[model samples]
Target: MSEARKLLVLVGSPRRDGNTAMLAEGVQRGAAASGTQATLRFADDYITDFLRDCRTCRRSDGECAISDRFRTLFLEDFLPADGVVFCTPIYWYGMSGQTKTFFDRTFCYYAGSYPQSEEVLEAMCRKRIGLVLASEETYPGAALGIIHQIQEFSRYTHSEFVGTVGGIGNRRGEVAHDPRDPMRGAERLGREMFTRHYADYRADTPRSTGVWCG
Candidate 1:
């Protein structure tokens, strides 16, 4: 039989058992049921420092000067994954600091600073990207900024933007009681993570007009 697809889930929340973590767990379960090997990693555990000035800290070999676990997490866990899911609690109406820092460090690869820049870019293009967010507000646009950011990231990397799941909650474990049932959506997204392709409904539907649901 063919090898199982690998999924890397980066949890950006500091709270190990918070609302965001719960949603991530649901996604993992769904991915597992679909025969995917899911690896859940906490950003707080591996990432300690933010991306620094590349001019002063970058190495000749294209590695970041700041020493941390992020390098290994990126080169080994992230680059090898067939699908990647970013799980973060919406902080100040955007992705958490950990998640933002993780993306910031990828600048080296995109800047062609790496020796294997071409290969790294190629690998990124072949993967599928997903997002999971938990927030205190259920407002319509609370998570829009993050969603747009992830969409743009996928576009820039030439990867498929699978989808996103947003949960509403303030206290720990409150997401489980959300009426919107974001956990279920998270699971569904995970199950289809490997096979789903994003499409603009407005473009696909000929009769569509200027109405924006989101």
Candidate 2:
């Protein structure tokens, strides 16, 4: 039997028991059912400060010394994951501040000139996949805008843009009422992608290019 895939799920919602979490939980359930080894990382659990724009990551070493919880997660977990699921709630027509800061802190992993280290690039190019989960009430348009940001992140970071799940009009576990909710879709997307590209996964999907798992 093939070894199970290592999956990393990042939850970016401030509300631990909100709709976003509910959707994330569904995705987690689907992944677990597929026999994939999954890890859940919550951004709210870790207190992080704003990233001071000092351009410290621009040096040849390309490392950030902001001294926060982000540093610990990067060194210990995120960098080694086979795939990533990004779950966040839309706020102010964009992703939550917590999620945004997480992206900002990724600077600590690379060099200043943005020279893509082979390992980082490989992580992006190889088994990397992105899943976005967002929630909105009447104004789901904002959620669409936020998803663009996630797509941009995928392109820039060399991660594969698998797909996105937008849960609208449903608060709490209302999304669960819909059998075909985005959360379930997100989980299935992860499993399908892993299955299709199990052995010879390609990361040469190119950066700054638009690709969707639709």
Candidate 3:
């Protein structure tokens, strides 16, 4: 039998058991049921330092200069995964600070500052990416920024941007009661993360007229 696929879920929410966490848990369960090995990492627990300067304390081996738990997590858990899901609660119409910081630190790998940049890029090209967002606002545009960012990230890495799940909630465990039932959508996204291929709208269709559909 072929080896099972690996999925790394990076939760950028500070709350341990909040609305965002609930959506992530649903993803984990569905991924597990689909025979994918899903690993969840809370960003607040591992990522401590914000990336200030890539050249300040640059390592000779081309690794991130900042000394933090994220270094190990990126090298061991993230780089090897077949798929990656970024789960965050929307903050001020954007991704959470933790999520943005994580992406900012990844500049080293894609900027050719890393010794194994070619290999890392190759791995990224083969992976699939997904987004999970939790927001208090039911407004359609609330999660748009996060979605666009992830979509562009996937394009830059040459990875497939599978899709997204946006959960509307504020209180702890409130997402479970969202009328839209985003928990189920999160689960569906997880199950299809590795198998689904979304066509690029820019390449396959006419430019959008900025109309809000959701």
Candidate 4:
């Protein structure tokens, strides 16, 4: 067996064990089946009251200057993780505030004053990104904008966009009842993600380099 890849899962639902959480757990379960080490972080708790100010955000270090709950964890865990999964509930055709805001904080990586700032930012972009969303609507269009945002973000950072899975639900744990069996699809996505072993690739140089998408 190959080395197990590390996956950082960000759950954006205020309800820790809500529908989105269950869907995320399906992905985790599938990743584990393929020998992946998946870490789940609740984005609702991870996002703090910290707002952005370029002066304060672009510190010497490649991290957010604000002393918030997510600052240290994002900088530390993100560096070592092989892939990231943003599991969010749809909010008015957009991602949950917790999910979008957390991603906005990534601006600190490219804005930092460190000499290797660009290199660090580029390296940070190498990880694979996946999305898991839950919406109350029956139509899949609710996740369109959110999907486009991830696609654009991946293009900007040079990260590989894996794919997205969406479910229809409103009440807690309702995603599990999705007629399409979304949890199974989520598990399959997670399993296939690591089966390719693309997450293990690393760019050792601090300069510009290509990322492994497969």
Residue 190, candidate 3: alpha-carbon lDDT: 88
Those runs of model 2 whose alpha carbons end farther than 4 Å from true positions after fitting are 54-63, 113-125, 138-140, 178-180, 196-214
Q: Candidate 4, which segments miss by more than 4 Å at Cα?
A: 56-63, 114-116, 196-214
Candidate 4 local lDDT, 1-214, one digit each (tens) = 6777888888988887788999899888888888888888887566785467767555565445666677555766765788888899988999988887787776665554545566658667767888899999988677889999988887776778887888888888888888999999889877766454333245673533565544
Question: RMSD to the native, candidate 1?
Answer: 4.1
What does candidate 2 score on TM?
0.75
lDDT of 3 by residue, 85-143 (tens): 99999999999999999888776676677788787677667579999999989899988
Clashing pairs in 3: none
Per-prediction TM-score: 0.89, 0.75, 0.89, 0.83
Residue-level lDDT of model 1, residues 61-144, one tens digit each, is 677777788878888899999999999999889999999999998776656666787887787775799999999997979899
Question: In model 2, what is the error at residue 83, expressed in angstroms?
Answer: 0.9
Ranking by lDDT: 1, 3, 4, 2
Kindly provide the TM-score of model 3 when superposed on the true structure, using C-alpha atoms: 0.89
Root-mean-square deviation of every model: 4.1, 5.9, 4.6, 6.4
lDDT of predicted model 1: 0.87
Using TM-score as the yardstick, the better of models 3 and 4 is: 3
The TM-score of candidate 1 is 0.89
